[model samples]
Target: MKALNATLPTQGLLNFKNLVYLDLSFSTLHNNFLKDIGKISSLKILLLSGCQLSGTIPAAKGLCELKHLLKLDMSNNDLRGTLPSCLANLTSLQQLDISSNHFIGNISISPLGTLTSLHKLQLSRNLFKIPISLLPFFNHSKLKFLDCHENEIYADIDVPNLTPKFQLETLDLSGQGDGGVFPKFLDYQHKLEYVDLSDIKMKGEFPHWLIGNNTKLYTLHLPSCSLSGPLHLPMHSHVYLSHLDISDNSFNSPIPTEIGVQFPNLYFLNLSGNGLIGDIPSSFGKMSQLIKLDLSNNRLSGIIPQDLIVGCISLFNLILSNNNLQGQIFPEQANCKELDRLLLDGNQFTGSIPYSILNCTLLNMLDVSDNHLFGSIPGWIRNMTFLRVLDISENKFSGTLPSNFVPPQIREVYLSNNRLQGPLTNAFYNCSELMTLDLSRNYFTRRIPDWFGKFPKLSYLLLGYNNLVGEIPIQLCNLGQLSLVDLSNNNLSGHVLPCITAASNKVRQEEVGTNPYMASSPAYMKQPLEFTTKSISYYFQGSILKYISGLDLSCNNLTV
Candidate 1:
């Protein structure tokens, strides 16, 4: 049906009772059209997702006639209202999805045990303030899938202790309240797999039975649970588990070597933001199917095993930030040709970036900041055309920055706090898409580049504590998008341009906010992007991190 516009006539659809399938999804629809569709009693399949249908789905009025609806999808729309208990009348419903709506109010009248034929039900991403534990009923044998996540539903309640008659394949209860213990009822569910219990705090040891008992449980996530005590590596050797994330907890233990011997098919593994100590195990090398591996923000020491580079041939993302790792990065990393995003910042990694990095031509984001690396900055970095975000700050590297240093698609560059000395290169002019640039606390000589004024998206320009001499580049005033300007502690001798002052005056509201491009403020810079006042430094975050902007030409030979 050509239902692309709201002008489509629905009067004829009311007379068509034999129409068994009707889908008006992905169209500009109105409530009037929906009301006419309800008269078709033979509609076994009805899909109206993304129809831009506003207001609420009329409750228990016309839709109640579709007793033969086997599948009904009204997700991804503006429809909002309370839980419609009238859905209980659709006894033939095998699938009913109403996710991504503005539905609110208590779901107290849910006809749970009544719909015996209902199999798959989805009500995720709604505004309903209700208890999640009361969703499933024990007698519902045909019900296989039930998802009611992210609806403010798991507030203080206890899951029923009764044994489930249905064997569920997926159970997601993320962001839930305290569950005193692992639901023992799931122990009987050997067919259980793909469970997500992330952000759900529970008291006691890790649920080892989930691995030792149910070898079929493949995709499991228990992050941010705050569960205490040492870690326990599962003894399962034949399980084909592919995805596992137990990050952001107090699991104090060394990464077990048996991980490679067990889950050789692991595609995604994130154990970051935990208290994990000791070395990353060599077993990670066995994960040839691994695509992403993040063990950052922990106490893991020692070097990344080179075997990982060889075994995990398909590895793309490798984030090992905020650890105590001490060693030179291996040049063989380039052997993993599919590697893209590499983050080893906030560690003790020494020596220069391996020249082998150039072999990994598809590298997108590379951050090795806050390390003890010391060497002349590599010139070949300019050759990585796909490189976007590069941060090698807070190191002892001393030398001239290569000409044409910035890649075309580069968004952010942080070469701050180094001994680098030379004329500030105009390579930055090539970064038309640049949003942030910090070359502060260095010995860069010569005048600041005038081409900076030509940048269309430049917001931050920090070049403090340098030997840069000459007048304050008045051309910089042309950057109307400029927000933060820190040129303090330099040999600059010129009038403080009034346009620069006006640019700084447009502070982006007084608040510390979240940056969309970054995980947190610390990840964006070696330290908080600070502004000094009276020998004290205060930092900011988000798009307004430099919102309260000001020219810091302090201790400079500048005139008013």
Candidate 2:
């Protein structure tokens, strides 16, 4: 720390009278020595974010001396002090950002409200509090952007005269100390482009004008705000509301058939975690711009909308799990050639999976588990060369798994509780990239395949309640990644390999544990942690956490 402070020769730095910008962010600055830089009288912009500095902010008399300063950014630092009151003296200051710092004490913005040139004020992730009846400090007409989220500010917003009256476009008040009905501030801001008021306990029906008149709004996020009742959509067609996310609320009512009439430009719509019921409107098929749609964990029922699958061709993700949708699989599922993720688990969809979707070359995940799906597993599934996850568990799939069904790139395969009756040689030999393979409760009658050792990446292997006889092979220990092995209730009659048992625990703990690739990787490669917490005693986190079978695995003798 001392080395960095001494390296900045104070001699050459003082004579730079024409210096207009000085950025030393992500540098190893020590202590509260920023006041020394204020000596550069002609400095217009001073940036010190992400610097290793500490201690309270010093008096800003030297900072005020910079009469030509336009912007001052000290964010992402360890600076912990009451905001300097002298900042108001910088009449030329247009933007002030002190976010992600350790600033403490009440943020007295009354001095800032008087700054006629202040256009942007970023005091987020700090410690501040204002009266419930008083509005946030933005009374100046020049203030255009105010980001005070993740703070301790609690106000019911009663002041009508405390208006900024500026052309503010973005206001993020998420994670701040706020409650009661949402503020009627948006009713005034006609030019707002982005607004996020999530994580605040603001309740009441969805505002009519927010959906109706905020035509220029591109992003509208109000998740977990406890807003209830039918979604009262605005009837304006010119409003290009691109993203509409109102998930995790108590809004109960049928999904409006006019959803397409209002949010035609919506590319992302998440109406999950609600009490919404009725079939998805076929009018939603008109939203050609949709890329991701999540309607999971709702009371929505009836047949899945075939129009949605056929219309939105640009879609890549579709999560409709935990609903009451019935009828055969949507015939238009093949239309989405760019589809990468298809999560339709926990529903009542029946009939065979359309082999017509093999054209989606980029397909990575396919989860249709816990449904009423029947018919044989098709051999064309081998065409999905990039397929990584395929879970068809808890279904009535009969006939033998195809011999050419080589899912070399597959990681997880859950085909449990099916009518599969055949030797495991073909399935285990081809799925070399498997991380999990659960073929339990099947009618397969044959000696366990010795080729199982080929699956070097195998972690979970559940073969219980099968008609497999003979000694458990020690060659199975070749699976170094094997963690959880449930070989009980099988017709095996020999000593179990200690290495396999230990590796099975390693695999179980690892699969159930942490995959290091997930610690720092993309969302598709990552796994969510699942454990016993207080509020959620049996909570599970992850994209591929499945329940293959019950606690009991009887019917076959275990000679371990």
Candidate 3:
């Protein structure tokens, strides 16, 4: 039973002589509940996950007496210290899960090595150090699933080449150690369906054999594994494969042109942060089931293939930022209506915002900054009612700000360094959810609006290098969440309001929530907020933006 605040009576539990199963998950149990629990020798399954259990597992007459326990789960607790030696007495345990705990010690000498009947073991997010060779579990012929990620599992120079007795169906050893080699034991694992070896310093070429051998494999994540050389695919198509992420690697080859034909069922693909060159494969259009595709931060050039844009019907969250890709932003035939977050910044894309993108009605965050695009900022952007972040800065767009620019849900608007002119309008007064408004280095000429104080969540306000003229409004003091304010290089004349200082001091003590748009996907578009402070321009993004508090009224006619 979960969410029950009732105290677990150890005496009452011990009276149940035939209690074969007991689950107190997410319950608030007394610390002494387990003192007499071991008396229930008939318990075959015990689930105490999220029970708020703390300290070490009792080693005396607690869990050790449950010799007939076939399954035990104590995950998501504060349990720590070495596994009790008496735990090895549970020889019939087929499944044991102790993940997300503070348990420490080496697994080689631990009780897990003796649990030969274990078919499923989850020890992830612990402080354990396991041997890379996995020699201790060689005799566990019945084992199939083992997840021990986020630990100190390391490699040894003398790792044995002995074959394992069991064929794993799922294995996750990601984030085990740094400067380690690829697990050689995987060569013998043919029944693998899910594997995650990410964040381990395993330096090697792409393991094509992984897909060739494990025909049933569906998910393979090897991001940040120090893999190099050409990323070779299997000799034939692997229809069962779906999720694949090999991002943040050093693969220095072109993406396989026929990758779509190879893993046609892939729903998620991330090959970002690699050195891959050549044009994006047109075959990607054939992957009808694809949902999220990230190919950002590469040397890939040439225009985005039109076929891929129109064919990937289920596609969303497409990130092709920080690449050498050129040509129009979106082809007229672009039909990916499910697109949500489109990040095409830091590229050479030309022309104004395409109307074809309007088909993506679910768009939330759109970043096209640092491009060669020119023309008036589209006013139809308001139609995308779900839009939260709009970044079209560093372009040659010359026009006045649209009267009804963004949607009411807009949280961040970055249009700095563009040719946009004229006064800040009342269009932003309705954007109550706005958090960051960066319109720096534009040609806008007018008074700094007093209604800016209407935005309750406004944090970063950058209006520097504009020609606006007026007094710094005291209404700004109403923004208790104001953290960073920039009104520099303007013609505004006035004494620095003491209330402005009060607002800044108030924000310093106040905690701010993360920008919802930027927080959506950690690997997606990270729109940086540029502000000049202390005569230096710094770009802040992600979590670091929250703590960045500053006030820039420099180069203005403001007095102390």
lDDT of each: 0.77, 0.71, 0.86
**Model 2: per-residue Cα lDDT over 412-510, one tens digit each:** 777877888877667647676677677876887778778888887765577876777877777787877554466656677766567764653332223
Q: Which digits, one per residue and each the tens of the lDDT, describe model 1 over residues 1-560?
A: 55586555567777987999988788776677656677898899998888887786566766666889899898998888775677678899888888889988765556645777868878788886545444445666887777767766443365555776777777776755665555666676677677887877766566766776667778889898777777776766745688999889888888777778888888899989887899888888889999999999999999988788778888899989999998886545546678888888899989888887787778888888899999888778889998878888888899898877768778778888889999977667677777778899999998988888777767778898899999988788777767778888889997889888888777464434443322223344333466665667667655445445665768789887
Clashes of each: 0, 5, 0
What candidate 2 gets wrong by more than 4 Å, as runs, is 1-11, 60-64, 106-111, 129-134, 157-163, 504-560
Q: What is the C-alpha RMSD of each candidate to the true structure, in Å?
A: 4.3, 4.5, 2.9
The segments of candidate 3 whose C-alpha lies over 4 angstroms from its true place after superposition are 2-7, 28-35, 58-61, 425-429, 450-453, 473-480, 507-525
Best model per lDDT: 3
Clashing pairs in 2: 483-504, 483-507, 483-508, 484-508, 509-513
Candidate 1, residue 118: CA error in Å? 1.6
Steric clash count of candidate 1: 0
Error of 3 at 291 (Å): 1.2
Candidate 3 per-residue lDDT over residues 204-235, each given as its tens digit: 88898999999999999999889999989999
Measured with C-alpha atoms, the lDDT of residue 32 in candidate 1 is 76
